[model samples]
Target: MEDWYYKVDEKFLICSICGYHYDKYAEYDEENNTPFRVEISGGYGSVHLETKKGDWIRIYLDGNLSAGELKAYKNVFENCNKEKSYLMTYEGNGFFTIHFGNPPEHFLISFKEYLENLPEDRQNDVF
Candidate 1:
């Protein structure tokens, strides 16, 4: 597997390969400095993965993810075992699923409730 990284610019969060953008600031709260909601659609709301052939594949997350949920995703991505885990998108679906391990374990991940409520010790456990 090749090294993969992502960057968050003023407008978008883009991955190294393909440079596909994801997570755009949408509605803001009264403070205006913090985003209350984020838009996740089209190529702008997708995760990019490099294939063995050096091509790129995208997992589109259509809909909205709260700031907390977004942070949870970032934590998981940053802490997970990159070589063993992958993010997957189901057809006609708008959420991301995490897959990992030798036996090929998988789980559907959506909303802030799931990720944010994990025990503090297990918060970074992505497997």
Candidate 2:
């Protein structure tokens, strides 16, 4: 397992090896909407999200992501559209589908720079 640490000032959970930073709180309130538990091990882990219905949903991250992808995730969380509801969905393999507005405007984003550096066979393989 890689040694990881959190940066309080920036609210980032960073990977020591590649220095990739994952937004700790991202735009969610720590007191309420934040992930209750985040377990990162061997470069990948799960985030436990509390739903509006009071159910806990465990979302897994494969840990293969580029800086752009992380930034996009943060941007989605930090920005508020005029729409009353916004949903961000992790579509596995570092892709995210963001929906905004009542009728919903969809956006798909993923950064392949990091993954492209890996061997061709390992590029799409998840941890």
Candidate 3:
């Protein structure tokens, strides 16, 4: 995941559930200290929603997202969206979808790849 998308998704999740909206983490032009909403960072994994006015209520996930805490995550995001915060997730498919605004974003996360990256049985602890 791109670094800034986490922040965007954080804000997106908050907006989707709480119905509260604000652009708290506007991009900082450190050299100029100017506030610029980057909208979509790295062309993926980020959305620079310029306006702080919105009503995001209800978020959910389907598809290959079947397994373990993925359902819990879906429920949490759904409740949060109903309460008006936001998020998405899935299981072994190694991918999930995140919906925001006019369009949605799909992400990939390979558990097998992650396991391979881990040294020895360290992957066991990940479960």
Candidate 4:
């Protein structure tokens, strides 16, 4: 229902849930005083997100994403309905690995349309 961001050092994120970093994202929980889970781990260039509740999520770019792609993905995060789907930037570039469990196939179709509706600048980065 709310989104927040924070700058985090590399050591803060851990993959307790997945047991590994996916290179594009990672997450940590400070309430427990340790990492509760991490996403998109084991990559070079990473994007970190921290919530007001002291929870952290990060995506490691690993040089797979270009400037333009990253820009477009930022747009997606700003525009898409976060409640309806999950997005991951594990491989970087604008190409997101999305998971939509609600009405699964329908959500995928909607996501595809979301991409199609993007301006050319954003569309090109999806690989």
Best by lDDT: 1
Better of 1 and 4 by lDDT: 1
- Show how many residue pairs clash in every candidate, following the order shown: 0, 0, 10, 18
lDDT of 1: 0.44
lDDT of 4 by residue, 1-127 (tens): 1122334433333332112343312356565556444344344334444444455454544445566876666665454444432334335353335422122243234446866777989775543
Model 4 spans with C-alpha error above 4 angstroms: 1-43, 73-127
Better of 2 and 3 by TM-score: 3
Stretches > 4 Å off in candidate 3: 1-86, 89-95, 100-107
TM-score of 3: 0.23
> lDDT for every model?
0.44, 0.40, 0.37, 0.43
RMSD of 1: 13.8
**TM-score winner:** 1
Q: Using TM-score as the measure, what is the rank order of every candidate, best first? A: 1, 3, 4, 2
Local error of candidate 2 at residue 48 (angstroms):
2.2
Give all candidate RMSDs, comma-separated. 13.8, 16.6, 16.5, 17.1
Tens digit of lDDT per residue, candidate 3, span 46-86? 22122234434333322333366555554544433332233
Model 3 lDDT at residue 48: 19
**Candidate 1 at residue 24, lDDT?**
48
**Candidate 2 lDDT, 12-120, residue by residue in tens:** 3543222234543334465565643343333343233343445443334555446686566446434433333333434345644443323222122123455555678
